[model samples]
Target: MLSVQLFHNFNKYARITEADFGLIEQVLSKKFVKKRRTLLSEGDKSRYIYFVEKGALRSFTVDKDGVEHVIQLAIEEHWIADLYSFVTKAAGNINIEAIEDSEVWLLPHHELELLYEQIPALERYFRQLFQRAYVSLQQRLNLTVSSNAEDRYRQLLQDFPQIAARIPLIYIASFLGITPESLSRIRKQLFQ
Candidate 1:
């Protein structure tokens, strides 16, 4: 069951009402994913905004050379989705897969739209959410262009220490724009 406090927090930040909350609860559903499960695939329309409750998920895309590049990772309390596909109702370019057994709350776009109309505040909340996501994306792009691979890896580790222990080094490597072997070398050097 969704906690009232969580709802209150969201409402306080988003300025939604009780009736709107009830409607959102009715439309949203919970889902579980075992480790390695694929939540969204490239070329599929994204149906939900997934909020992680446990474990981790990674979103990535494969290049022409068949090399996978990580786009983002979401852990407990984080949200993951292909925003383009979710908002535009088009096929997604990225794939979302579970890195570990996970629990998620899924919010469908249409149902969410209903709440948005009935409560304009809900739309404001999502607008703020989009703004934050965009700002983070810009920061990541700046880091990728300006930082070296080792520096990028170090930053990721410093920002999300739990990821160092829970995620496979290879995935972390890809996320940091380094090859797995390169990440291994870095790890070895750091430990020494």
Candidate 2:
């Protein structure tokens, strides 16, 4: 299952041979996490980048007032990691937790480097992944600055309808940078 999704994700950026797929698979380790389990905590060093095979995970940060801000959400076939920590071996400021019972495949930093050397095309694949992530982040920043709260919630619904169905509304509200009551009012207006 994970192999199929992994190969699909890799092939999106580059052509991968069976041998290449096998090589990539060899470096991956599978993990299952229950809902609410924390995979990576704030201030912890990130050791592995995870690819979701099933369920959902969220990355977030807690502010001084203890308000949690959702930064990213990864579902099936998506990748999740504290990229800063994973790349620099520094403490991560974000925490990643399972929003549902999840199955994931992890690639350790060492093995990822080895795989890049062994399978050079993998480097291109990863580069493409980073590029897309950067673009997404930029788009999110633009949306946050330019869009109204209702428009933001609508855009989120248009872009990731599955998120509304899969995660709690409070988390979705946090991700949209709006209060739950505000989101409720927006939803009522939209539906009415």
Candidate 3:
């Protein structure tokens, strides 16, 4: 099942050969997380990068005043990790929490290095993944800086429609950089 999903994800960019699939199956471990559980917390070293097999997750951080700020949302087939900590082996500054009961396929950094060494194409595959992730972060930053709350909400819906149904209004608001009441008003305005 995971192999099929991986293949589908890579189909547009590159094909995953049987050997590559075998290696991934061997090295990657699948785990389940219940809603509201933390996959990684602030100050913890990120040890694995996760690919969502089912459900959703969110990455966020708390401000000095203890206000939570959402950074990114990951749905099915999406990847999540603190790239800075994952790559640098430093403590993560953010927290990744399960938004729903989720199944995640994890690839450890060490195993990933082995994959790169054993399968040359795996490096190219991850390079493309990093490129996409970078572009996504850039776009998110641009939206947060340039767009209004309503615009951000609409764009979030456009990008991930299922999120609106699965994530709480408060979380959606946080992710959009808006207050919960403001998001409530925006939702009413959207339908009208």
lDDT of each: 0.86, 0.91, 0.88
Cα lDDT tens digits for candidate 1, 97-174:
999998888999988888888888888977887888899888778888998877887888888888777889889888
Model 2 earns a TM-score of 0.96
What TM-score quantifies how close candidate 3 is to the native fold?
0.94
Model 2 deviation from native, Cα RMSD in Å: 1.2
Clashing pairs in 2: none
Every model's TM-score: 0.90, 0.96, 0.94
lDDT digits (tens) for residues 54-168 of candidate 3: 9899999999999999988888888899988999999989899999999998899988988888887778888998998899889988998999889988988998899888899
Q: Each model's number of backbone clashes?
A: 0, 0, 0
Residue-by-residue lDDT tens digits, candidate 2, 52-120: 989999999999999999999889889999999999999999999999999999999989999899888
**Which has the better lDDT: candidate 2, or candidate 3?**
2
Which ranges of candidate 3 are over 4 A from the true structure?
Answer: 1-3
Whole-model alpha-carbon lDDT for candidate 3: 0.88
